[model samples]
Target chain A: MKWLPRILGAAMLAGAAGVGIATALEAPAGDPQVVELLSGLNYVPSQSNIDVVLGEGAVEDLIEIAEDSSIDSDPGLRIRAFRSLGQYDGNPQRATAASALRRAIADYGAESSGTKLLYLRASMLSLAAIDGGNAVSNLVTMLGHPSRDIRAACAQALGITGVAAAIQPLRARDLIEPEEQVRLAIADALFLLGSKG
Target chain B: MSVLAATAAMLSLYLASGLACGGAGAGAPCQSHSECDDSYQCLAQVCSPKCTRNSDCGDGFQCNEAGVCNRVFANLGDPCGSEWDCEIGQSCVLEHGDSNDDQKLESSCQEQGEGGRVGSTCIADDDCRDSLCSLGHCSQLCRITDDCPDGNRCESIPRVLGVDDSAFFAGCIEDTSVLSTTIAMSESSGTLRIPVPSSAESFAIVAEVSDKIHLVGVTRVDSPSDFLLFRESDSFEGFLANPIRYARSKEVSTLIFPSNGVQEIEPGVYDVEIEASLPPFGPGTAVPKVSVHYKLRDSHILDLTFYFLNLEDHPCKESMGIDNLDKSSAKNSDVFQDEYLGEIHNIFGYANIVFPEEPEYVNLKRERPDLDGITDEQDLRDLFRLADNEDGLAIFFVRSLPSDGVQTLGTTIPGPPRTPGGPSSGIVVALDSLCYRSWTTLARITAHSMAGQMGLWNNRDPHGITDPIGDSDSSTGNLMYFGEFGGTELSEGQRRVLSLYPGLR
Candidate 1:
């Protein structure tokens, strides 16, 4: 009869462990069917459980580690956190706190065909932010990203930001960025801002 | 070593249909992780800790990410270098950005590929944050766009503005994240687009390594009735390589194209096609079924994507392009001509059931209500329906599907198209093709130069719209300018075609 208490304690512990797994199972389920689920976009278990999913170091984080600019730089953990934040895009509260879309772009970029897709989700909160209307300040950081795609994408975002004052600055310096694509992208941004070519 | 003894070979195979092993370093003469012992998880066939000597990484590979051994997964068509590799059906080619010997963190296929998400830009792994091959791209996480950042639209470059993050730099109408990218070779407008060959429409047979030609477009045709535009002597890295049409321009596209000024090129896979005739200036129309020469270059170096013309965007068939594939039957080879007939390309080559993705005729029949593009099985239906209905239309369709997205030709296929997977669209597009060559060659010439296929195919090759418009300003007597999508200035070759057949368009 005394064993019952110990069994109860063990049961509680088991339940505690299952809570984490249950969150994961429910969280975007992380790309089931032999596919690696990206962290921070979908199936993050849940917001409450996001920490746990990230605790295990997700797939997207590994990609960051693999692609970082600084040789031998391990950006995996940082990416995991950012990806977790990105998953919040579906939720407004999450979007405001982490701006999952911006977090992702800030971390990675949309230079290639595949990356451009991230914009689909980013468009959501991006529009929301624009609606809230502090866009120019929001995009300022993105303008400096090393990737031209990101810069170009950010320029697009600035166009979405819709703040009129941004046109002059966008046109003045015009992203004297190194890459031609960046220059073209900045040119595109200015054009989007309705800057006279 | 003691590590082997201490860990006592564990037999952990996930036995499904075939033995699925977790692998404990017990395999021999293996090549990649897919070749390990029944119970071994081989990274590079080492059967222990996922790598043999460093060379086991194949070429352009390095070990990283918890000893998970990374390797480059593309090289010609058969480019998978790992066990968990994205084969023909899998959109898993890692898009490493341009490598700079000066930069330590430049793109390297050395490790696992860039399996990231769509819309995410990447300079290094730091950007991806969470490595998932999303939207046909590999990336870390959404960085700059408000999708992941604060409420911001169009951010300026922070470093220049003392704000050092993605928000200050990039912007767009939509939020975005970059996975990985290469240098944009040609201008987005393709101003440097070179002209077609001198005798682009004619047929020429030459046997010199330096024989020169220019490619206008390429379509993979099983029938041997088109043009032969590629040469064998130059263009390829290896002998016995498939022929490719060479593009002549002032600058090189990748390392693929030769030096500028001299249009002369070597042999390799090229999309552009050219025909030769001893009478290079055109005017001869006496021939019936003249065999023009061409080549299909291996543009595998191009980055791949998973997301493509979403149903909601543009003239997507599933969206508004075609309300439903109600199986319409029309008269003659086209609306105007009556020479030959064409049907769907059959994917129902049952004996050729090479990949899981290749759809069955039955499956296609079920999806007819929502079908937009053609599958192998649907292709067969096209032919069957054509012959069955006697529509007598040469149903020439072109698609810019990536080799790894749908069923792969030349080699065994992997599977059918997985929407929102592996650059759901093909990068190697058969652009600016025509159902009836002679009927639409002029418009097609204009379209091909613009990089968009205006063909009335089952599916539209968006790459047909590869170029931007507003090239010149007006389609003048001699030259045509960009018109919002693409710009085309009549080159020497094109001028020759126009002069030879006045009022062709």
Candidate 2:
């Protein structure tokens, strides 16, 4: 009975269906207020404290939902939280979300599951949504990661960034990247960036 | 009784009592209007003779337009002249902009399609195919965002994966512009009992409900009396994740028999019980329920060949024992025949090939990656070269993959007829050393590779970076879903796609 509400609450929080709640019992570890907010909804929440959380500088709390690996969080909630952070309009909180994304990419490794990889990739895209000033340089640095997925994520981030600065690095990465998917991502990034310029 | 006399008496009774009589007149029994004879058809579920056409009935009655003898206001989609003409599910609307008689604004009952076909234009979700009308056009299926039609972006096709995790590759759906007022409603329901054929190689069941609160499951136990065993620790989610334990498909509502290396069961009274929990319905609100059951009859069996390769210098090799070849071959083949594809294909009679020299062995792993640890394109072609004349699927068991679990779990050669990879489609699986064997892993890999080769796409996210079907965020118990080894069954869409395979011919 409690499971239904927990699932419904998490699903609404994430705006997705059956993302990653079925594998384990515990919700994603995060700030106590955020956790309480998520756990209290026994039924679908028609309204929430999202605006309050965002306005009261709960960007870090949202990031915790995105970053917490103790329990597998639904990608929708993390991505949504990240997007909200990107659009927060405040410089410091926005920067915090961007930095969290960077740390996630920097720490991404072989142990990452496909789902975790998706969360990280979405995180990078969140940075692009904000037009994060240093996203181009940060993504360019990520192009050298050993894992093809991270490099591809970086390429996608750069494409979404549509920054002129990413063009040269993307072209260079496109030339040397061995993985077909990563190479394609780099090509797409180059096209998007070039088109924007 | 004469028609006038009967009609007058029925009219008199109707006027006096304002109620219907079930056994009134010649008609002895009746339920709803639909069950009554032409003479008696109305909402009262009575035996009173009702008009066949509008003209026959008096002031209050008008013939129902669907050709039903009963007379009532227009139902959904019926032609209407006024506001009162339409029924509960219908609305009256104008057909033309002109006011003149030639092109006058004559209206008819208008209702949305609710589930139109792809490429068709629609004003609402109901007008679109699959109730997924978005951006004025019915949604298209896609692998990537680019595959979708213009002005439409891909959205997840829900409930096709499993309850625990999502399978992204159940195929991409377009985002609908129309917000559905009703959360979940399909076009069917009831206590449907499906008969299992004696010759069935395998069977799979899929249950998809609208809300997370609705619990849908399938079991083969004697009755729901054994439901407790299936509902472990009071956690429905946990129980759903492990359906195979309680004779249910894991996560998804699917089941395949002769499972876990067991022999086929004899034909008997196997009772398959389905469970669905209904939520509280609001008063006066009509809620539609959805339940679908499919039984694949006239089974078809496909041939399977297992080619075991060994390196002369390498310590890893297949061990032979008393009936080892037959037993292992049957076990491996069962994964295809009974576990996943059994309902559609009866995979049987596996042929094994052993290479004594290391050169051919080396060539297989190195040919494309070719023979070293994985099946390169060349490895697949070479293995199939010695397969049975009619054998369409070949699984090459190599001594070892260079990187073990990291590199050589299993791989499928993308083939012609769908994607242009090679002349044929097959799998190159790297199993554990002869002593430390795991059948589940091999079966899992084979299931993944075979599905790919058979033209089944991996249900990955739109970005297409995930590995295997499990990675796709599908919540259904589909074999193509990631996270689990064996699948409950191939989804209906998957079955339709795989039906076109040359091997199934």
Candidate 3:
């Protein structure tokens, strides 16, 4: 009976190692220091340092935290993650970060409208920063969001992208935007783009 | 013959004798030299006396090349060469006009009356009658208290633009009145209207919420659709988007109407709405509280409490060692007070700082491991809770902050007024970075952070966004510039926003 109990304990240890191996194969591990810095509040490390420390795992880790929908996750951390992704403006992984942020627009869910709005705003900003030309279409769709704040934020994000394609959609939205604030935002975007040209 | 008729006949006879009329003297209003007394010439609609130099003409009159003492209009906006050339307002400000021609912009007398009356709202100098608009009002220029209207005081204005010493001026500003109240949150979400009195020229609302509430929004009751929204999980972007309306932390928020004193804020009812989460234990839980501090008028006295944090065991302690302030020495030392407090006073002439008690040596590191570095919001909230002081602003001095580049200094943007032990508790200054610099530099950093907490934006942000205050220009010398250290000059509009802080008494 003692031998049988020992064998069962060994079996449990082996299963745990197998699970760890599976996770390692799925994604590269992030440096503990990088994780600690990112998890903390107030200070954000520079993008160059993050890339040097985490290498290719940087974008994957950020995307995972940003897309996390669990109730236990801190909403503030998710927002920070989105912003950090935006710092990778010139990196090759920026495209991947942008795609993840775009997906987060639909995947991220919260009970409170305030939380949802904040997440959407962060995603919009990061997307524009990462790939302005590609982000134009996604931002254009959010111009029709039910919340006026979201629509206004979308228009502002479109202007920040500085892509020529954003100008036409913003001008088109200008005529149809119902809210005064949103309409003003659309007009500002058009003006910004027009000035850039 | 009545007495009036006899007096009129004598005056007519005197005028007919060819002797200059003796009724009007120098500086008196006159239509012609014949209406002035002997030896006095009528110039620019006023009687002027014969003179060789400016000194012989007396004050408010300058000797012209024609050897006559000419009356100086020297009202606000009138061009002038020196203070002596101006009237009661001693300031002869050197202005750079809008004309591309460089010579058109020159020194002009700084006084008030062309745009609007005293106490009227204004956007720029051109909008006021006085040619000098300060704190959204047409403030009269003055050389002394006697020059100001009753109930107002003549205060020195900080020179924010150029280095010219002649540009110095003083303005008349009113004192402040602060009112505080608490609103009980009865439900998950609801709106409450706070009445604003007609006497209020400008107002600020600071709301400190309980743990349960996660969001708050403020707006004029008449215009509910365009409200300022503040969430518990706000980031730097949130604060930047609504600089005067949002706080960095969740437990506290602020909303300043006409933040830069440029916009017109109507005196009426303002609506505040809060959204809270239900207590896990269910309905019988204690109701959440939202403390509100409403301030009216501008120009105030602020109290400060410095907490010297003990970072003996801090992981990121500066290599040079922490310079822990001696509590008793700091309180009694005149040099220490003059270094920082004097700089603040220089920038905001009406702002007075008083230390209610000796500085406290606090050991926040014992409460939390990461407190020595303050890397996150929870850590800051914990530190503030441990060193909570409701009497005034609580400034925590730490060894170092775990940040990159310019973020070594951390503070709540627009701190909650009169609230203690919350997320927006106080300010944290990294002594490591400031130890080697002069105390005046420390004062600049402190003043900049304090102004931010009190409700002021940088003159210009990275996105090329300027503050709503029309008087504030983007210059490195400005106290509200984005840089960590520089000049300590504060614009009149910046002072208005600083005075609106609820913590100011």
TM-score of 3: 0.43
Evaluated with TM-score, which candidate comes out highest? 3
The DockQ-based CAPRI class assigned to model 3 is incorrect
iRMSD in angstroms, per model: 28.7, 19.1, 26.9
List the global CA lDDT of all models.
0.27, 0.41, 0.55
Q: Which stretches of candidate 1 lie over 4 Å from their true place?
A: A1-132, A195-197, B1-505
Error of 1 at A138 (Å): 3.8
Give a tens-digit lDDT track for model 1, residues B208-243: 111112211111211112233333333334212323
**Which sections of candidate 2 miss by over 4 Å?**
A1-65, A71-99, A109-122, A129-134, A171-185, B1-503
Predicted candidate 2 versus true structure: per-residue lDDT over A1-197, tens digit per residue: 11223333443433232222222113344453344333211111112355454445566766776676554554434544544455544455676767887776566533333344444555666676565447776667778766555576677678878677788888888888886656766766787777886
Point to the candidate with the largest lDDT: 3
lDDT of 1 at B390: 11
Ranking by TM-score: 3, 2, 1
